[model samples]
Target chain A: MIKEFIRKRSIHVCLVCTGGCNGCDIEVAALLSQRYDLEQYGIYYHNNPRESDALLVTGTVAKQWQEKLVEFYNKVPEPKAVVAIGACALSGGIFQQESDKVGAPVSDVIPVDAEVPGCPPRPAEIAIAVLKYVPPTLASYRRKI
Target chain B: MSSVIWYLYEFARKTWIDRFLNAKTDPEIAEAPSRFRDFPEVQKDLCISCGACVFSCPSQGAIKLVRDEERENIFPVINKSSCIRCGFCVEVCPTEPKTLKTGENYLIMEEYRILPQEKVYIADEYLCIRCKKCLEACKIGAINFKDNVISIDQSKCVSCGDCINACPVKGAIKETYIINIDEQKEIINTLIKSLEGTINLEVERIRKLPDHDPDKIIKLEYPLADYLQKARNIIPNDEMIIKTVEKVTDRLKMNIITWDDEKCNQCRLCVNECPTGAIKYDEKIGKVERDPEKCLRCTICYQTCPFGVPGLYVARFLLKNNVILITLKPSQIPIRG
Candidate 1:
């Protein structure tokens, strides 16, 4: 039916790196390579948020990125999803105890859809997250658990 | 010539045809359970709070043993997120059964393992205001400025504490454990209630003028450490703060700097131990006496007393059980702030 038609069409994903170490970005790159070949699964990766159906955010959000995170989060069309891609994004991770945390946990500034906790998750993890977590999140932004 | 033709067919089959064909499911995800490494897990009951893991942590606040607001209890809280999974905490825990049990195969490389007594420098980059002033003091080129952040390269840092000496902010750089103020939430909140009331009233009276800058953010000392930090943060004596804060919730219970005459034996050792000369022998009275006003209430008299006769305990603060014992004696010392 209509769901099958939507499944075949690509999910436009925007990658937003706030201030992370960029290891997760490398994993995201691997997902698009020939081994994983994310395009085959009806997915498209880009930097622009306005065209995106999903937003994948990685890194510890600094004060400078706080406003930008909200701006980008708002730009995505209705029924959009946000994937917090690393430890810093989920709970400020290693930076949790930092005093004067201006950028802080991403959830503080914008609504988060899903959290993937790892220093840097493997490419398989990211691919699995796209298959498992993203669409359900897009269906409804409420946390699955 | 036949072999060359055969290899060309194999290479074409590998790329053009197979590029379109691949496994439907990811293999690594299936193998994740076997390949992943879970960080070390702590056994709460087994831990002795002996400062073993605290000594083993590479940096401060990584493994802290602190008490709750009640001060009647103590526990070990590990920040596994900051832990490098080095297994040093597992190795050093002295209990017959280890306290920090290594979750997976914790293979410690010699370089990753910090010795029990070794020191490491730590700084929270968020606290670092990129005022490149730390650069001018360092000659070794260990301090690097990049990405709007000034940082210490652990590999190049000499642990000389020069950066700490030069920094205008006390905790901007540290040679030992970075004393994060967030850990003392109870004391900070208590201070806020006490200090805020006075400061707000004073600010309201002064801020009615047009000269007051609206954009200037007046930072509150929310953390007790923020109140105490000087030009350089030499690790403060935590035990002293913990003891004093616990004993003197109300000033009425504070140690009167008195000693037990029954146990005094007039060793006069406590007299020597008094840094402020609070304890002394009166030749005319032919007995050891204490000048309460001069007493610093450091508990050294109780700690050093050979009799172990609950001598300094009475001087420092009345114990819950001994409050009745203290009420019997008439003390003329009026409370002083």
Candidate 2:
């Protein structure tokens, strides 16, 4: 009940970067600006995974980050949702050709609730995806509990 | 004390509030530009199944040809996941409404539109004599001879069929019809049947005659021009129809010229009259010798020979079960004495 009440008041999103061209990171960062104003909807960009309710993952998971990504996902508290941003996070993007350097998509390492597909998805699209998917995922977790 | 008062005054003014209130937000991100190329939309009916889109696509497995179970027509299907939305498929689509469209307005330009060709003219490199006659005959200069090869430019060609007419070799420059194949096959069948029917009666008459020589040659009583005219009525293009008839006649070996060595009086008349120099008197052989390889079978020697040395005969053909059976028969016209 306390978790639901906290989520109802405000949602905290943690931005995770495994490995990519950093183009999707720039677009995600755009959401913080007043133009997109992601915080207007009571969403806060928290650096800590434990405090965050949702995790927005960008870039293909490189070999080095493969183990660290699972550790990061485990750190997030229960009733947490993961949203994959950009083609790289979804399917390894153009780095798919270099199979040796980059691991498979983020979904293979951790469960993904929603996906926003584009070379570098628009900030509005990422904002919409996070808003639409995170609440339902949290609600389903509450029912399980 | 004055600096402190100035700081208080600057804080009270709040000059940054206007910029924050009028923030630039791009609410129109969903509304893409007119030329923004998204995934291609396939129009199955407009596709001619030429595979041009498939050939032109840069991304592998982005577009593939699929057969329709109900209509039995082949059309292209776009794979959304693999497609990069390059718009190459839309640009190369030859249909009017276009088989594939990316919703781009610039594709409607006159220069980008490549219409589906009804018939494409191509030169058979092996058969082409490289005489350059077609190059000269083409008014638009669509035909080119480069590096010992003759090629036709499809973009510049008007399909006027002037090059086919100017070609000395029958099959050198050919017309390949990409559309209405079944209709063309029907017309060609009718023409072949009519031609076969006309020559069938004479073949039966020769078979019934007792002690009749199969080698005997006679003139055809009826000219084939009327039957050719009937074929021309169906296919308005004279060159294509003529080429079709010529191909059929060539397969049947319509004319056979037989020369009698004894009848030649050594007058050397046929040798003088022969256009291709196929007939020549060899002093070693002590008689006139005709080279079969050089002979065009034009029947010039048959016409010029006074003593009836060279004989001309027509052949009747029956195509049964995919096999063509040819029979030689003498014509009904009286032999010149």
Candidate 3:
């Protein structure tokens, strides 16, 4: 019952930044500000992967991210969805073919469910993507109902 | 009494009406209000797969120009799985309409992934002369020949384009098709079926003739390594070899000799005895590379190997797995039946 209650009332999102300009990271921060009040949607952002239900990743996956991304992905609990935010995570953005970077993308390491593509996606777009990724079977479905 | 008026003023400021009045009516949700640059789009008609956009993009495999076999043009494929949406593909495209562009609506929101797709290398049958050298050089047993035509297993093909490099004729072997493993298997099955049909026809014709008599000398229809001297001396008039023009069809492969590297010590004696300099022993690297192009198949090196390293090989050695299906043609067989 407690597990069901936690799953329904709260969604903890863990954000990871690999290689990029961090433009998407800035937009993601705006989603939880006083004006946006992301808590109203029952989405709680956290840094710890153990407690997080959803993971949001930003930046073009560089060589270093190969090991680190998989490490963080493994830490996230079961029944979690991965979201790749911004163009870098989508297609390595401006750093796509740079030699100094690694060859793999975000999905190359872990399974990704949703992609919000933009130079830096808007807060509303990021919000919409996360909400959509939450399965209809979850307790969040009652809130929508 | 003055402090009571101040408290009433503070309560009025703290009221819900004051909070409602202070809140802004609308807020800008996005960073830029009107910027259209986001996801890059390729103009199919205007853009030539010149690799300009792929080179310009910062991501290595993100913006790829895949060759369209039908159009004979390169098509820019933006790998959405890792696209950073930096709009570099748009900036470098030289076309008038700017073959690549970024816009608010040009987003690919579908679920996507990058898989290791299998690609095949195709050899031109008309140009290939049933050479087994490519098969010998190939580290992986992905290639085989049926009746002198090359057959490839796409699943095993790593798309290394080594066959292209090994081919004597320019553009004889083409690296084509970027497809998934499932689709590649379907194409290979159909190709192998057609090749087997041609091989069976040759097999049937050879089987109809009588056995060769040991008493009578046989005039070999196909050239053998023993005929190396004849090829060098005779002014040939064959279509593949014209003496006046000196146009040579040198793609012919016959395993003239085999050497067991383990038994033989690295002696430069065999290298020195080679007439055409086909064998080269680099003392610095302690490596030996045999150039098939220069080899006349004159058994001098075979005779010089003191360690009994050389094994006499026939034309049948060219066959994959040394399976000789039909070495003796109808000419060699007497029509007793």
Top model by lDDT, which number?
Answer: 2
Error at B76, model 3, angstroms: 2.0
The true-structure Cα RMSD of candidate 3 reads 24.8
Taken over the whole model, the C-alpha lDDT of each candidate is 0.59, 0.72, 0.60
TM-scores, all candidates, are 0.42, 0.43, 0.39
lDDT tens digits, residue span B1-337, model 1 = 9899999989988977687676356564335664255456676667655655755665333455544445433445666434444556777778877767665443333233233323455555877877777788887887888787786666676667677777887557755432443444444344334443433343433233222133432232223344344211333556534433333332333232334466657777666655555577898888888775565454556656776422221111232321211221222221111
lDDT agreement of model 1 with the native: 0.59
Selected candidate, larger TM-score, 2 vs 3: 2
What's the C-alpha lDDT at position B179 in model 2?
Answer: 66
Candidate 1: segments with Cα more than 4 A from true spot: A1-10, A39-42, A94-101, A141-145, B1-26, B33-36, B51-88, B91-97, B101-337
lDDT of 3 by residue, B166-244 (tens): 7777546755444443433443333333333433444434333433343322122222233333333442323211211
Give lDDT: candidate 2, residue B101.
Answer: 80
C-alpha displacement of B321 in model 3, angstroms? 64
At residue A54, candidate 1 shows an lDDT of: 86
| DockQ, each predicted model | 0.08, 0.02, 0.20
Best by the TM-score measure: 2
Q: Which scores greater on DockQ, model 1 or model 3?
A: 3
lDDT score, residue B291, model 1? 77
Q: Candidate 2's residue-wise lDDT over A1-145, tens digit each?
A: 7767678558899999889889889988888987777887678998899999889998888889999999999999987899988777876655664345676578889999998876676677788888778888887884453
